[model samples]
Target: MARSKKYFNPFKPSAGAEPPRIIGRDQVVLDFVGALEGGVGAPARLMRVTGPRGSGKTVLLTDLGSRAQDIGWNVVNITAGINMLDDLIHELSPDSSVDSLSVAGNAAIASGEAVMKVKHPNLRALMKRCCGKSKGLVITIDEVQDAPIEAMQLIAGSVQHLIREKKDISLVFAGLPMGVMDLINGKALTFLRRAQSEELDFISLIEVRLSFRDGFAVSGLILRDEQLEMMARATAGYAYLIQLIGYYVWRFADLHRARSMEVSDEDVRLGIENAMTRFHEVVHEPAISRVTKGAMEYLVAMAQEGERASTADVAKRMGREPKATSSFRRSLIQREVIQSPVRGYVEFSVPFLREYVLENADELLDRY
Candidate 1:
């Protein structure tokens, strides 16, 4: 019988699986690695690694935590927010009552020794044993924007105290663009300047030259230079995009071997199509629903026009005035459903989200 064929899945990492090998981020790795290696004499002041949503900020933080562990530093990763902080602390601390307050206090104590000095006797007792001679502990926060304001305050105060006491403790906060703004604008801003601010962006040309080939090798695939360019263009050099592409490509290759006993470019093209379909199904559909469901009809209309609609354009489009539309636009911006990509252009940063809204929103677009 003729051999069957295999296909690729572009959305392989959609559910938060790590790429078997990280590619095209050497500089970021080096910078985070330096922090992990304690290049700072004391616990480096609170540092930040910021990027957009779907930019792989969480994965990078997770990777850093793993690296910190390899180097023998105490590491904590939190995403469930301040409510979970106590539990996290408890896990690291031995003498803690089940009482929430007491557990938080104890965890704080345990973490104190590992990264900063402990003030509470409970924490102090734990740290002396846990921290030993280590200079500091590493705490990494993912999706920091989701954290409650109170939690943010408490964490900021904790680190500030550590700094005041001349103890060692360092932090890594990763999140979307606004998360960076949150860190830089509020009380956290003052403390951040005292430490370090490293912006993690897409892979540079130099890094691509040095590391991209090796990364593909590790994943057991081969790509022509033109194919590489296609991926880079499609993904905009976003870290998550790289992994998403790599994963689907690997799956494609594996399937080809299983069925056809061969892999080819047509298989790659099939993978890309499947990936785009999956992207529309898995991510874009739900995002569009949540954003438009509660929004006013006019706002949904504005979103469909690519968020780049001018105030005048939006009013014209909505059969209203620029003056009336301003308030509506402001609300969308605040809710983060739409954004001004530059000073003038506005668009949905999330892939296909706006397109979905446009396709479905009646009167959002004029008949053309």
Candidate 2:
């Protein structure tokens, strides 16, 4: 009913927070529309997106759900964890609740679902009813990596059954690249294996530049073309980094430059430094914590080298023979932590991961 007051930070850096304008993701939205309009059994109806942390998987799902809502579709978005199946059922249930349904952190379910009734139903039954009540039904799951296997199986199986019966439904989900593969490859999720899969990565630098221009103009914050280019390059085309840099830059201009709202070259520098500090905490630590000790050693060894880490050199650094390190290399590749650019060399797949490893290698190498 009312708009919030404007804040200096025009960028929304928090995960899943929709930015004023989504950039470089036109194809995803286009494909979603195509799939939605194409009806059941459309390859895009069952879409799975995979990406490393901070690569905008959640944001993409949020965008798609909003688009579906705009077009008379009943969109239900849920995160994968705990009682995710129950949560989905609750949303589709009458009154957005069933006396028997179990959910957590969903107080607004009743207000949002706009439903009325007292009976709880199974996923298939509830979804079919929801589909019947809407022009179309869209169920989007985020962080699919953490989805309980049995719940995921049930959801997938229900969607599969619904599809066979020709109910207008769509199932789109996103997760880290590694976990998505593991989930789909599980025993009961064979249907997921055939879904249209997408891997998100860096967006174009030009798009980031344009976004920066628009975000800056909103607050009358000015950066010359050269300075804007420098700031854009520092982001390396990562979506989170773009938000972080813009947020910090805005903050610095807001607090430090009270007299002038303009952004200077030095502001970009300090902003990036602070942004990286936040990035390390929010993105790097959790990501690296999940890597195995042996993989850390391999990554640390690779980080020790400036660029294009040679297998032989990495093995030497890890105090292992070249042949003995192949497993670690393959493991990292499969997990999308690293990539083999050339036959003999590897590199970090995520931007600045190598730098982070190098800066903290003494503590990271071989750490459990």
Q: What are the TM-scores, per candidate, against the unseen true structure?
A: 0.75, 0.85
On the 0 to 100 scale, the lDDT of residue 303 in model 1 is: 69
Model 1 clashing residue pairs (backbone): 109-123, 114-137, 115-136, 115-137, 115-168
The digit string of per-residue lDDT tens for model 2 on 270-321 reads 9999999999999888766777788888988898876788899999988999
TM-score of 2: 0.85
- The digit string of per-residue lDDT tens for model 1 on 1-368 reads 98644343333365545554555545666766675554444433366766555667777777777777777777767774655556545655745543433222312221331232333333333433344445456678777777665455455556655545655556778766665676556643355545555566666544443343455545345666766566556555666555555556556666645444344676567656666666666655544343332244545555656546655665677777667666656665655556766654456656555665666566432221
lDDT of 2: 0.82
Clashing pairs in 2: 95-115
Against the true structure, whose lDDT is highest?
Answer: 2
Candidate 2 positional error at 275, Å: 0.7
Error of 2 at 152 (Å): 1.9
**Residue 294 lDDT, candidate 2, scale 0-100:** 84
